[model samples]
Target: MADLYKEIGNDSDYGSINDNSSAQTEDPQTSAPSPSPMTRHQYIVFCGIALAYFADLTSFSLIAPFYPIEAKEKDLSPVMIGFVFSVFSLVQFLSSPIFGKLLPYVGAKFMFLAGSWVAAGSNLIFGVLDELEPGTQFLVFCLVTRCVGALGASASVTAATAIIAHTFPDRTGQMMGLLELFCGVGLMVGPALGGLLYSVGGYKLPFMVLGAADTLVVIINIFLIRSSEGMESKTKGSMLAVAKIPAVWVIALTCGVASTGMGFLDPTMSPHLKEQYNLSPVFISLVYILSGSAYAIATPLWGYLSDKKRITRTLIVFGLTGGGVCFLFLGPTPLFPQVPTDQVWTVIVTVGLGSLLLGCAIVPTFIDLLNTAKWYGLPDDISTQGIVSGVFNSFFSLGAFVGPTVGGVLQQHYGFPWASTMVGFMFVIMAILIVLFGFWEYQCGKGRRRPPNNDLTRQVSVNYFGSEIDDTEENRGLLS
Candidate 1:
């Protein structure tokens, strides 16, 4: 290509050849060279990661529909059930940062494999919990086992995210969206299958199936998935280094607040449905399934839009604003229906719509936040990416931990209305922050304008080998 350019430059009669070549390269009508087999291999690796992610989420969410039922049998209260659910995220939140710091040295592949095995072991134990005498012993065992499983999830999820960021640094939004699609599908399938399986056999069956699936994934990764260490940096970077950035803190806060709103439904929703409408376990799971379906469907669309239209800011602001509104209208108010007696369908429809709106906003927020982290000079290396992934998960897990724990207490005392209102207020505050910080700090702060291309500000490019390189500042500053 360089020789052709030089040859064209030497021709006085074809002075416009250089311009034509440049135009041709940029034109959609022009065909580029076919991708190498290595590119195909990268996609296969992505598939493996997706599968692992699916299994990871399924193992956890599988318990969502029926765990409350199990607790009730043991004479446990809503707060206790919420604690059982919260324990998982609590452990996950604490473990993720440690995993992040270790990722630079251990590599994502190793971390994922180890995590899968641990999670499988924990799920297997959880499956057999019914064998124990029911009561405090049972609840204690459940909490402990779930926390152990969370430890594994922390490792696997953070590593998988880091892997995606490393694999598709240039296309992180699209790839993250694809990952979320898989995860959302897993979340949907977990509850549906768990509920059905529980109806047939028991909770034991769901855990066993998901545990076995994760075990199989570990084997598949050993054989088919390539090493991710190639993308990792030789020297390690500090997690604190990434955390020091103001934008990183902001993004983490946003993710935490958003996650808290979503977490409100976990403990409170199932019980709310059962008590208010006398919904069966299967119907309860269906509610979550519908929400997960919406989430899965919307993720790719948001990702594609962020990538193609450079609408990260637009999506973030819109999603947060819209999600906040949904939360406000989530439960019965003076304006909204309270799902009165014989109004079962009304509650289902309204909650389902809220879930759909949450889906639209949450996934986009994640992609945009991660993209912003990278743009804020979060080091374009695998190790650094891993830390960012861990930090992201940590914040999200923290929110998940707090939401159910607090929301449970609120719902138990006041009702879903109070719980929903609190979550709604959080989203409202986050939306305002996004406009103030997300837009102002990066877009209109001082005298600087946001670059036309989101990545242009970073001046980074990916080579054919999938390595990130810095471009010339002059060339990078050009409008998209």
Candidate 2:
């Protein structure tokens, strides 16, 4: 058996020997070395970051199933409810990019603590506000607080993704696949727990639990997490330098659409169900749990496929468009007052609606979109990735902003069907944009601009993914 251990330079950081053969290796047949203790340390911080990220997202997501229930409890209009959710998305949109810039200077530890505290404090406050008032127009305040909370964790997701991506450079897609697994688990578990808590305790329970959990996340980040400590750049840089790269523009747009699609399915869907069918709280909770599972299962498969076939962009186009059709099924059908609440058709309709929402392919498209960010000049550092991710997340935040508020109005005024109906159209638009961007890149040719060995990205599309444009002189010498 191979020794599975070896000595190499610069073991303090989590960098792997890019070319182990040239890294003073003992033998090719020798067993690969176990990751040094520092690597394990990095992994722990990554996991903590993931935990915080997951907790925040899931905390908000869990609200999906309960939206209608809360509406019923307060007799609040759907439009008002939509505004609350959209506010959180909007916060992420404006601040995520800011986190990117602020993180490098303020550091992840500070931002993480800041974000967690914002989330915890606000959640605690929301419970108090909700209990004291009826029709208090507190939606704006709630949203503002949530936005602040979101800003705190704004850069964490992309930061974590970039860290893992660079840590396992050769298997970036595979590692991303693993990352999505954690993401899926967080999303799935968060909503389910919320539903159960709501059923068992009441509306306030979910907020209380999330507030406490988030506070713990802050503590962990402060005490347990260690920074990657990146080296300085060889070349001086500026925004103009990054903007001049065409690939970056294409990636920014592509990621934006993919993110929009992901938002369409979850936080928005629960409210749609509530108004369309006038469903009860417990039932909505069940649906949310189910939907979360769909994402969880679909994401890992998408990552694996993107890795195996390197079909990042194609998958993005396919998943966004295909899964989008599920929203169409959710569009309001005329409701007859005479139809029994327990009619067999209700079950049939439920079965048919959003069915494709959980298929295995969703993860692939999403992974490709995120991977595309790096191709566009996103810094490889975790902190830089956070800022870069914040840029795309702005679009996702846009979707989050739009999905609920618009869906709410349409659902309230036109009925639940119309709210979802609009989302299906957004899906189509996103899909078209993805295809156009990808085709342009393909036509331009895979000149030296692309990494010399970007096989993983190439595999995302079974079709030839690029053109034969003239190679750049800078890349003439070596692999990307």
Candidate 3:
């Protein structure tokens, strides 16, 4: 197993012992031995990351069920409420890159623990906002706490990605997918739990309970997460270097567009169901649970397929295309006048299917970004991992920021159908762009001289993109 790890670069399907020799010789320090199978310590770290993801998302989503109602009582308008939700993503979008750049300096373990602690503190503060008399003071405090929470979420998430990539270099996609599964569970659990707690003890109880639980998870992680001392890169990585890669830009765009669909639904979906189907808040919560369940259940499978089958690109195209079609029918939009929007079953089915496909589309993005960056000549080091993770989170958060802000205004003015249609269009367009990019890659590979046996650069490209474009100056210029 150790020999296999060294010989194959832990990428058995594409790289052979001969092929990896150059990579190892070029940067032996960075090409440390890979762990082919999970170690006991690795399992502990994986579990800690999973729990941290679960806790972070649970806290993020818990407010969904009842925050708006309380906000209404405090005289906040729909747009203002939307802003409150968007602000979290806004902070994450702006702060994630900063955190990524800093990950090497602070260390992943410290960032993870400190971030979880900050998030926990914010949750406790958010619980108390309800105690303030309804006015500007209440709204101001609400935004401030949410911003703080977003900062913590960004820091923790960036660190978590770096940790995962470092710990499981070979299984980044599968691990990310599994982590997302926990996130999906959190998404499902948060609202339902929040609604229940809200019923039993009102707003304060939900935050107090979940926040306390999150703090506990952080405490356990303090012992479980090992320091990333030796894993740190000798040189700091540049976010600008990662951003300059054309393929990275494509992945980032796809992530942002896919996330927009989710963000669009968050602020708009419940009201749409309420207005059209006359469903109660409890039933609406169930709708979200159904969607989250589908998303949670499908993510791990997608991740496994991505890593094992090397179908990352295929999955993204399929997921985006299918998800777009689902969204088209989600509102049973104006474009699909034949479909009935008034039926409860239509809403449930579309939302569930859409969420599932979106999960498939999103699960492979982190690994895809990592692979693409490596293919483009970025060193596979902690700094590179940190920058890639930051880029992924930054773009996803940008979509999250844009989605709710725009969706709220669109739904308020134009109605849910049009808003849904707009998101559907974006998905389909992105899928088309990805397909076109693949075609161009194929064209570039055509008629090029076959690379030599030990050509690590060409082998890396073949491993990732299923193409054999030569690593020539001309080809690099063309790609860039």
Candidate 4:
């Protein structure tokens, strides 16, 4: 049995050797060796990163269930509340790129510590801010503090991405899947925990507890976390250079737009449901849990398919198009005119369906963006990964920033239909742009101009299952 096991392992390695040899003969730089397995130290770092990420997300989301109520007490309007929510994302948007650029120089571990300190400090302050004199000054103070916290949160994210790219460069998809899982868990757990804390001990307890939890994560990073030594890069490229890539710009735009669709709901959803259906914090938490659960479950599946099947482009197009439809049905639209109004059951059903679809759709967008960045002259190295991930994160934060700010103003002035319609329209337009870009890229071979990469060329003949057994130069003509 031991001999048979050895024979099977040898055969597996032999097949990989043959495939690698043939593939490299076409373009030696296009492919690299599969990444090495994780050492015990690497595993420790991974845990630290995951927990830190979870803490970051939890800090951001802990206010989800009760922020609107707190804002209302301070006599804040929906639009003002939107600005308050947007401040963090806006700060994160600006800071993420800076963190990305600095990751290699300062090290991800140091950045993580710095960021954790900032986020935890600001979060603890949020609980007591309302004790200050009320009015516009109070609102300004709240927004300012959240923005500071956003800077810290941005650092944590940048460090996390850099560590993953550095440690598991060969299996970024799988590692990222784990990252997303922790992200979904944080998002799901934060709101539920917040709601429970709010019910039991009022508003300040959630912030205090979550803030302390984040600080604990900071302590872990300081002690257990170490750099992925020897994985550093000294590339001199800038964000401007990455932005010059047409495909990267397109992917970034898609990310921002997709994020906008979800962001529109953040400040508005809790209040809207409370007004429309009178949902308690606990019930409201359930809505977020369902959506987050769908996202968490679908993320790994989508990542697996993209990696194993190499159907990244196909999935992107399909997911975006389908997600747009979900947004339409989510809003007050003709498509779902029959989804009953003035009932808790209606809100539960419609929102659940929309969240599920949105979850499945969002999984493809980031992976493809990360995958496409390599094709557009960003070398597959730690330095380049920092910039690419930063840009990717910045665009998403930009959307998050815009969605709440604009959605608040729209909802306040124009009502739910207008805001929801605006979001749905953005998704539909993004889907169209992505499709057009693919056709133009295919026809002109623009994506192939930079590197000797065959990703765009190979994608021509792939079936939905990702089978490309005949993917070769000879088959390129068939696509034409």
Which prediction has the highest TM-score against the true structure? 3
lDDT of 3 by residue, 1-480 (tens): 233234334432222333323234122123223338888988999999999999889888889879999999998887688789889999999999999989888887888899999999999899999888887888999999999999999999998998999898777877988898999899878877888899999989999999999999999999999885656766577676576566788878898888888878877998898888889988987887888889888988988876776667788989999999988898878987889767788888889999999988888888788876665555677878888889899999998888878888888898998888888888999999987876554444341112323344544444333465666665554335
**What tens-digit string does per-residue lDDT give for candidate 1 at 1-480?**
333333223322112222323323222222222323337767887888888888888877888778888878878887688778778888988989889888878888888888888988898899999877777888889888888889988998888888877776556667777888898888877776888888988868888888898899889987666675566676465665456456667767777877777777877888877886789987887787776677677777777665555555466667667776666565654345553545666556656666555555555555555554443334567767777788888988998888877887888788876677667777778878867874455344332232233343233233112346555555344322
What is the RMSD of candidate 4?
9.2
lDDT score, candidate 3: 0.80
TM-score, one value per model: 0.78, 0.68, 0.85, 0.79
Candidate 4, pairs of clashing residues: none
Give lDDT per model, in order: 0.69, 0.54, 0.80, 0.68
Model 2, position 214, has a per-residue lDDT of: 76
* TM-score of model 2 vs. true structure: 0.68
Tens-place lDDT digits, model 4, residues 1-480 = 222222211221012112221233222223234446678877887898888878888878878779888888888886688678778888888888888887778766787789889989999999888787767977989988988899888887877776776676556656676777888899878877888898998978998999999888888778888755455655533566456557778877777876776777776677777877788977886786776676666667766555444455566666667766665555565446686556666556656665555544555555565555554435556666777778777888998888877887888897775567667777777778877877665545322232233343333214111344575675454334
Q: Report the lDDT of model 3 for residue 143.
A: 95
lDDT of candidate 4 vs native? 0.68
The backbone clash count of each candidate, in order, is: 0, 23, 0, 0
| Segments in model 3 whose C-alpha atoms lie over 4 Å from true places | 1-35, 341-343, 444-480
**Whole-model lDDT for model 2 versus the true structure?**
0.54
Model 1 lDDT-worst window of ten: 7-16
Once fitted onto the true fold, the runs of candidate 2 whose alpha carbons sit more than 4 angstroms away are 1-39, 62-77, 130-140, 195-205, 231-251, 258-284, 328-379, 382-384, 410-422, 444-480
For the record, the alpha-carbon RMSD of candidate 1 to the native fold, in angstroms, is 8.4
Question: How many clashing residue pairs, candidate 4?
Answer: 0
Report how far off residue 313 is in candidate 4 (Å).
Answer: 2.0
